[model samples]
Target: MARTGRRPGLGGTRERILAAARSDFGKAGYEGTTIRGIAAQAKVDPALVMHYFESKDGVFRAAMQFPVDPAEFIPRLLAPGLDGLGERLVRFFVETWDSPAGSPFLGLIRSVVGNEDAAAQLREFVTREVLGRLARALELDQPQLRAALVASQLVGLAMLRYVVRVEPVASASTDELAAWLGPTLQRYLTDPRVTKVNRRSRRRR
Candidate 1:
């Protein structure tokens, strides 16, 4: 039986627009790429690009698709009754970074490395799409700080391994690194002493 609604490839103009936008965003950094360029590349109208994505940032976000949404990822990472969560979190990040899903992520990171405009764009994307959203979803206290620490851990490791390709650090297995680094992140994520004052207020609740 044939299902109703738009078929996969025949989803019409919108699919075409996204396909073009992805290529443009990947080849060109967030700033370097434009809606006009995407429309031209996709052989569509500029209006269509705007129609689908709303703006360049929207196009980039859609282009660099993530396997896991932050709403799901953060809560799972911070789930109660899960001890040694730091290691699990590190493992999750390592697996994602090493997977095929991470290619677009790496591309975005490389784009941010040198250029100021690209860096700013990347920062906004990371803070809003990746970190801030996760914090909001998880109800994590001091979301900005937690997100920053999480980013520091993941990004620092990515640089050490993939970018700089440092010695033992680069070659180290994910489990090995997790063993060493999990406690540090665990402390950041859940240490009572770190938020002693805040914890006192929560206790009053």
Candidate 2:
């Protein structure tokens, strides 16, 4: 997988870097993952990572394999504050995936079922870039689990509507879906009752 002999086109080397970067980022999160580490994972020189991605941020962008940058967009989404973050998140998720721009994600998401590497990359990106960030922003207890719960909501919605194409749920209006889904997401992100219950449950065990 190392590009040794003559310089190969961007076709192979680039794909390799993306795959490696996704794996490391998925496992390590952003802060823990490094360019050198990704290069090593990809079986290529560090120079190649820099060459292909320019920096850690660039590598992360490519690894996410999504059209929108959740790191950038998430903060903006929460700029109005976390009061309606669940609604905001659902809107963003619905709008993006339903739009033409989100077309690629359908294929990318489908790949996750059978493609472990792709799935890892996606799982990391959503957890770190989207759900992880959301959890941290809430500043609540068990941010990791809270973020994961939120991610499950969005992912499940995507699978049901876009992938499975289930009736009623699949054809529901975004507003209707958001109204129905947003409250649960809101509770997951900010409800202290659930948090306290979960914490106590952990203690009992």
Candidate 3:
């Protein structure tokens, strides 16, 4: 049933904006999803949509609330002295994307595949949220660059394994993938040589 003691119209404006954004973004993607379309769908003035979210990007961010926030998970993923972080990272992602909660990720992949603008937004989101945070947690000197590198590798894996469903790799068990990928991630995160050039440049100054 409907939520108790609350009319359908209660909390209507915000809910309507979110609902409109979800549909518009899912269908038309980031670039195609316009304030006018959202306002039309929400049955509210365009100004109202802007009032809730300053821009399209803002609406997109609010609409896509992943079940697990990196703010909560990243610290756990990076807890000092945690051995086998690479394995844990792989396992965490595999488990997350395999579960029902990963529907949003799947939807995001589909959106990106179909729309270049949406693909850029997806890249931005991954960079800002996942890779950026991971870099900071690892205390990388160039957090953004490191995070983008990690995101590229992980996003590629997700695309091939889950979205494309490519043959044996796609069918490969999560544990198997983790075993193969964990070491690479470990090297990326811990290898002193990963950013030797950058370190050397800083040292020279």
lDDT of 3: 0.72
RMSD of each: 8.7, 5.9, 7.3
lDDT assessment of candidate 2: 0.78
Stretches off by above 4 angstroms in model 1 are 1-58, 64-68, 79-82, 137-140, 195-205
57-113, model 1: which lDDT tens digit per residue? Answer: 666666544334554566777665347877988888888778776666667677677
> 14-115, model 2: which lDDT tens digit per residue?
888888877777677778899889888888999988886667866776665466766678788889987888888899889988876687677788778888
Error of 2 at 153 (Å): 1.0
lDDT of 3 at 205: 38
Q: Estimate each model's TM-score.
A: 0.63, 0.73, 0.67
Q: What is the overall TM-score of model 2 with all chains considered together?
A: 0.73
Question: Whole-model Cα lDDT per candidate?
Answer: 0.69, 0.78, 0.72
Top TM-score prediction, candidate number: 2
- Please identify model 3 stretches exceeding 4 Å from their true place: 1-15, 19-62, 65-67, 80-82, 197-205
Winner by lDDT between candidate 3 and candidate 2 = 2
Off by over 4 Å in 2: 1-54, 198-205
Let me know the TM-score candidate 3 reaches against the reference structure: 0.67
lDDT of 3 by residue, 1-205 (tens): 0112223353678778888888887677666789899999999999987877667756666666444566567888888543677777888888888877666777777766887766766666667667877877777566666556556667888888888888776888888988988887776777667766634445453
**Using lDDT as the measure, what is the rank order of every candidate, best first?**
2, 3, 1
Query: Could you tell me which 10 consecutive residues in candidate 3 have the lowest summed lDDT?
Result: 1-10
